[model samples]
Target: MIPGYPKETFFVPDGIYLLSHSVGCLPVSTEKHLSDSFFRPWANSGGHAWTNWLDNINAFTQALAQLFNSNAQNFCPQVNLSSALTKILFSLPTPTHRNKVVFSARDFPSIGTVLQKYCKTLELEPVMIPQDRNLADPQTWSDFLDEEVSIALITHVVSNTGQKLPIRDIVQLCRDRTITSIVDIAQSAGIIPVDLSHWQADFVIGSCVKWLCGGPGAGYLWVSDNNIHECQPDDIGWFSHKDPMSLTMNNFEYAPDARRFTGGTPSVIPFTLATESIKLMHSAGIEHIHSHNKKLLSRLASQLNVNSPCQPNERGGTFVVSFSNNQKALQTLTSAGVHCDLRSEGLRLSPHLYNSASDIDTLAELINPLLGKRR
Candidate 1:
C-alpha cells in the first residue's frame, strides 16, 4: 500500500447499501475532485477552453489504458458502457453473405436493446444462445459457440446471478470459429485484474462508475489491434478524425486506432475525476483491491449463512451476494435502511473496498430476525 494515501471511507447511510453491483457510491475523493474542477475559471470560461478540455481527455485515456493492460492507442473514453458498445457494434463491417452476431441471453438490457434495434434495420440476425443457470458447467458456453457464430458478446460477471463466466475459454472458442468477441467488463474491470492479451477479446467495454468508484460518465471502450480494422466508424466526429486542423471538406478519415470509436466531446471534468480514481486504485495495487473486496463479501456471506434467511454460496466472491428471502423479508431489509435491490430469487448486496466488517455486522443484526428453519 502507498504511504500517505489513506483507504477511502464511504458514507453508505444507516440502511444497508448492498447495491454496489447496480451503481457504486461515489468516493469522497471524487466529490472533492468534482468540486475543485467545477470552480476552475478556465472550465466555465469562454476562451482557450478547448485546449484544457482536450488535454484532460488525453490524460484520462492514457490512465484508462494502463488500467486495462493495453496501450493508449487501444482505448477510447465514452459517456457510458451502453454508448461505447453501440458505437462499436454499429461499426462492424457487414459482409455481403454473412450478417449475424452471436451472444448470450444473460447480457444486460443495454446491449440487448441496441442490438435488437440494429438487427431490425440492417436485416441481420441477432443470435442469442441459451444461458444455463449452472455456470459451473463449461459445456454450456462450449455448446453455444459450436454453431456458425460471427460475433460473440459476453459479460465477464453476470449482474443478476453473480456468476463469473469463462471469458478466456469463450474468447478462444470464438477465435477457432473466426468470430469476433466483445467483452462487457462493467462488473469485473476494477474488481478483478484484467489482461486483454490473455483474454484476447476483440473489443471490451466498461464503466468506472461501478467498481472503480469514479462517478458517472466515466466509461471506456477498448479495441484489439487485430480486430480494430473489422469495425467501421458509423458515428463520426472531429475528435475521431486523424487531422483536426485539416480542412478537407469531402473526406472523413478516422485515426487508425481506438480513437475511431470515440464519437464527440466527452465530459472532461468526469475524466479528471476518473484519472484520480485510477491512480488511487493503482497505488493500492489491483491485487490488493481484489483481495479486500472479496474479503468483505466473504464476511457478509458468512454472517448470512449463520443466521440470515438464506444459504450462502461460498465460492461466489465477486463483492456481490444475494440473500434468499421472500418478498416480505426483502422489503424488511430495504425498510431498515439497507440499500439493496431484489433480483429474481434474492436480495442483492455488493460491497466494495470501502465496506468494513462493522458494516457486515450491522447488516447481519438487521437481517437475523427474518430467517426461518434451516436444516
Candidate 2:
C-alpha cells in the first residue's frame, strides 16, 4: 500500500476504476472546495466576488507551478488542449523560409485534426511521422526536424499505446534546429514527473481532466520565458490586456507574459476545481505517486499479455494488454465490475494511487481465461 495516499481521499466507485487515463476519479474534497472557493463568494457578493474568483485562478496557476517547478506567470488557463493549440497556432507568425510543421501519427487525433485544419490556412506543410516507424527512437524524430521545419508538436506520452517519448531529447533537438517545440503533456502531467523549466520547450499544453482527478474543461498552456515575447496571439480580449481594468478606448496592448494567450472572460469554475486537485497531488508528491504506479504496472505486466514498452521509464502509467478478440472480454470485464478502456491497440488499463494490488489480481483473474495461453 502506498503511504500518504489513502483510497478514502478520492470518491472511488462501486467497482475498480482503471480509467485514470481517460478521466480521473473525483476527489472527496472537490465539492466542499468548490462551494467555499467559488459558489459562496458569487452568491454572497455578486460582482464583488471577482476579487476572490481571480485569486482562485491565481491559486490554480500556483498549484500548476508547484507541480511543474515553473513560475505561475508562465501558465495561461485554457478551456482544453485543442483550444490552447489553436491559439498558439494562430499567434505564431507565418514562417518565411521554414514552412513545415512536424508531428507523429501516434499523437492524439485531436492534435492531428487541429494541425490539418490550420496547416493550409497558415501555408505550412504537415509532416506526420508514420506509426510504422519506431516513435520511441530519438533518431526517428531527429530525422524529421529538417531545415524547413518551423514547429514540432511532441506528445510527452502517446495516449493509446502508453509509450513515453524522450521529450527532453526531442525538445533539445527542436531547440538546436531553431524549431519551436510544443510539448503535449495531456497523458504525462499527473502520472509522470514534468519539469517545464527543464524541458525548455517553446510551449507546453495539458488538461487536468485525466490523472489529475480534476474534472474536464481545465486545460492550460505554459510558454517558456525565451519564447513568450515572440508570440502575438490573435485570440485576445479584455483579459489579454496588460491592465484589464484600464478601460482605454481602442488601445489594446498584449499582456507582457503568457496571459496574452488567455482570450475573453476566463472560465472560473474549472480552474477553481482543478486547483484543489493539483494541490492535492502536489501534497501527495509526484515521485511517490509515480513509484506506486510503476509497482502496480509491474504486477499487471507479469500477469497480462502486455503490449506497451517493458521498461517502466519507457512507458507512462497505463498498460496496453493485447488481445485477439477484445469485444467479448470487454463485455465480461464490464459486467464483472472491472473498469478499463478498449482502443484499437488493445485493452488499456490505468491504475492510480487509489487502486490496490487485489484490484490488479481481480482484473487478471477475470480476463486471463479469455486471453487463452500467455504468449
Candidate 2 residues lying further than 4 Å off, grouped into runs, are: 309-311, 373-375
**lDDT (Cα atoms) of all candidates against the true structure:** 0.70, 0.89
Deviation from native of the Cα of residue 53 in model 2, angstroms: 0.3
Model 1 earns a TM-score of 0.88
Tens-digit lDDT string for candidate 2 (275-361): 999998988888888888888888877886654643666889898877767777788788999888899788789999999999999
- Cα lDDT tens digits, model 1, 259-297, are 877765556887887877776776667777777666776
Model 2 root-mean-square deviation:
1.3
Error of 2 at 73 (Å): 0.8
Candidate number of the best lDDT: 2
Whole-structure CA lDDT of model 2: 0.89
Each prediction's TM-score against the native? 0.88, 0.97
lDDT of 1 at 11: 46
